[model samples]
Target: MVPRVPSPRRPRLPSGRAADAALAAVVLVLVAVGSLRSLIGERQESWETTALAWALLVAACAALYACRRHPVPTATFVLAATIAYYLVSAYDGPLLVAFVVALYTVAAEGRLRMAILLAALGLLLTGAGTLLGNHDVNGVALFMMTGWLVGVVALGWVRENRLALAREAEQRAASEERLRIARELHDVVGHHISLINVQSAAALRRLRKDPEGGPERAEEALGAIKDASREALRELRTTLGVLRQVDESAPTAPVAGLDRLGDLAAAARRTGLDVRVSTDGERRRLPAEVDLAAYRIVQESLTNVTRHAQATAVTVRTEHGPRHLTVEVTDNGRGPIPLGGGSGSGITGMRERARALGGELTTGPTLNGGFTVRATLPCPAAPLAHLPGPGSAMANGEPPRP
Candidate 1:
């Protein structure tokens, strides 16, 4: 037959002091019941005999109460008292109950080796007392002792299993939270930085072309600032939506790519900078990530030219092929490359974008007394079949003559 599962005992309050009080009261009532039975002529037992029995019962119950707070000490006390009582008289109900409770507590909460040692000691003492008291070696005593040992072992196993399950649940919850945070950072932070890099380059180009066109160039710069700030706000809202129960949709805008290079050039033109864009090879559709990376590299390079190059004209050229897409932004400006200025986060941001797209980017002085930024991006073999027509080239795939 399957053993019935025991209910989990209520946890004792403040070192089991309250549980001890309750156990003490129950023990007194049991003693009173036995005493009253003897007094009412319920049996032929003598007054002294009845009084001794009540005293042993009360002592055993008191030890059981204290066991919750001090398992080892209380178990020791119960063992000694029960053995003494058995030697004087014989085995009884109260003594058995107290001993069993003490054994279970020690096995569940005490160190495993210590609990085993204590159980061995208790068994030895019980056997010795029974032999000395002339109690018969019967099957009943053996059965009772076996049952107590089984109960102790089972209680310890159940407690360990419960603790293990709780720990596993906690770890799973922490892992899920980390994944959610990573997704939010990637989606929101990456988008805004791309927009900022694009607009800044456009402003710098206008400043170089028409040195006297200060008012118009300032207006273009202000517009770029407004567009970037608005994009940042929208990205922030999308990230915050994750915490709310309602499902707010992400904003849909045209993904910046090669098709939009004219608008990019126009923004620079508004700043009084003469900028030209040219393309070659088939303008086939590209992966969204690859397209975004190419656009940002060109944007950041041109932005740098407008800010630092101080040149009259800038050129952006794109070449698509079966194996790769190449982008080059060059300017005939007479300024040294500012590697140590710490004036901007633009260059670091550009490198991060290219790395994200599985591509390489390089920026430095060109051989013809100008600055050039070049990136070679790998493309899929199949998409090269659909490259754009010849008419799509910016300035027919050639830089404007200085």
Candidate 2:
């Protein structure tokens, strides 16, 4: 399998040419300052002193520019050169800025162990040279060196934290988007599929009863088509409500569940399919998610029968337990089942529904020369409120919640 590449997170810095220009300006300023300091008191300075000091100063500034790309190597070269200069002529100025920039780069790009090792080595070399070259190692020098190293390390730490936070936020947003898409797909597709399965069976039944009445069968098919179209419209409205704005309201309607299984079986029977439903365990009110998942599993299986399975009989079995709900739809359709043969929207939609409900779906040929779609969904402890109540509310004389 090919590895998935993660999206790049860091924003690109503006204009490399502009950065180079800025670096050049900084280098010129440093060189001019060093030259002015050298001629502070002397009216007539020796050519040797002037040439040697300015050359070393320009070399140090160039090292700073090189450090931008090759930080560790440039830092080492500059530190070594500065140490040699101090040992020979006891010259020192704002050259510490180059070392600080190099340290920051190393800390940002390298491993913690390597960054700390390089920092310790650089500090030790500079401090040792200062003490040995008769340049009094005062408190001010110690504070400045320590402060630079600390600031660079802190910057690296902050960068790492910000990157981590940004990654977490991206993952969270991706997850939310997946969920929203899943919900929209389910509502939009599930209703129409259900209506199609219903209308097809109705037409098939009418044709079986009166083989000569072709017009009647055609009319039934047309009715089924109409129902499917209306269902599609309803789902589209709901989905548009969600897409428009968070405050937009959706139409309230009954979603198919266990209660609608009987109607589904009756419709299939009308289409000449001998579909039987069996319950093996005690049935209780289940969570809306589990109920909907179970209902869709059976509906999709029946729909497949009408479309692919050239068989007469199909069975839907449901088993409810304390912690789980299991549903299986089986049919004696053909000899060999094409479990992974073709890609169809129905199959994909069913799989997505099962996953959204935190359930598992398996479909393949059975040992007895039949196809079966089985699903197991976790049952919540409490019942769903949206489900229809038992019998008529008026018969019980109970007032509905206001």
Candidate 3:
């Protein structure tokens, strides 16, 4: 069974406290004015009765200040005040608006069940008083009030759902970006570091075997190590630059693509591995995401060979079809091939990259005592007919030259 992960705690709305206070103040002023005007219609009532009704109205609207923080409690208080005001006053006023706002706040705070219970209780009491001839409100007014309360509850619930969905979307985007960064770091650092280790070890072995004669071979190994380290630093800086981007400015480093396969192969060859790259179909410019994915897959496959496969030679093949681009890395190594999609083998990450681009990746032992990683990536052919003629100073939506 899949384990349930709890949703993150909901963050407060922007300027939530200030906004809540402002809403309460506005409602209080409106309710006070409307209720005083309503009381003028019943001039025969005593001064004490008028004062009590006004107090209840103020209390109902004032309770809304804490509605967001204590939604259920505030809603209950507001409901009681509204009911008391209607019972004592000769006529109805806009005091019910305070109760409506309170009910909406309760539901918006994710207290749907509590809000519904309070609303039902208020409606029941109002209906009972009307039936007993204690309330001046008629049947039609009670029914209309019921409908308005129901709508307020529904609106609040909808707002809560929308906020929840937006939060989930943001979290998912952040998670995907983190995973992408990890894969880039693994490919960039892992390959070069493995090559450095191999070259350094070889140099040490040579010097131990023959002190004077081994110096020449050791020097060659050291040179390879220097090249590997330099390349690693360059790639590391590029990845870091992308990470440090805080605005919409252009990236400081260029993205790696298939055009750099020659350099990659040469680096692998320096570690005494015979690396060959072959292309079958006509190569064309690919989407940035597809190109990056293809490069990382090949880079990771070779890194696995250098670390696990005790092979002397490896072949990297690329086949560009009309709608898909295929990359295959094969090594004639006697070492064990990872049969499972484990994190250690980086097969999971590679598969994720392929799937992200609506593609698939497969890894298994080759027929002739070898291991191969094959990935097929979906790449739509660029439209050539829509291009501007050669004399145009821009291409692919780029700005024109000065």
**TM-score, structure 2 vs. true:** 0.56
lDDT tens readout by residue for model 2, 155-237: 86567567768889999999877765765565456546655766666677767887899657669676766766676787677
Tell me the lDDT of candidate 3: 0.84
Alpha-carbon deviation at 204 in model 3, angstroms: 1.7
Query: What does the lDDT read for residue 116 in candidate 3?
Result: 91
Cα-based TM-score, every candidate: 0.44, 0.56, 0.86
Sorting all predicted structures by lDDT, with the top scorer first, yields 3, 2, 1
* Residue pairs in collision within model 2: 201-271, 205-270
Estimate the TM-score for candidate 1: 0.44
What residue pairs clash in candidate 1, if any at all?
201-303, 204-306, 206-271, 206-272, 206-273, 282-387, 282-388, 283-387, 283-388, 284-387
Backbone Cα, N, C clashes tallied per candidate = 10, 2, 0
- What is candidate 2's CA lDDT for residue 244? 69
lDDT of 3 at 126: 88
lDDT of 1: 0.65
**Whole-model Cα lDDT of every candidate shown, in order:** 0.65, 0.67, 0.84
Model 3 deviation from the true structure expressed as Cα RMSD, one decimal place: 10.3
Looking at model 1, report the run of 10 residues with the lowest lDDT sum. 389-398
| Alpha carbon lDDT at 76, candidate 3 | 93
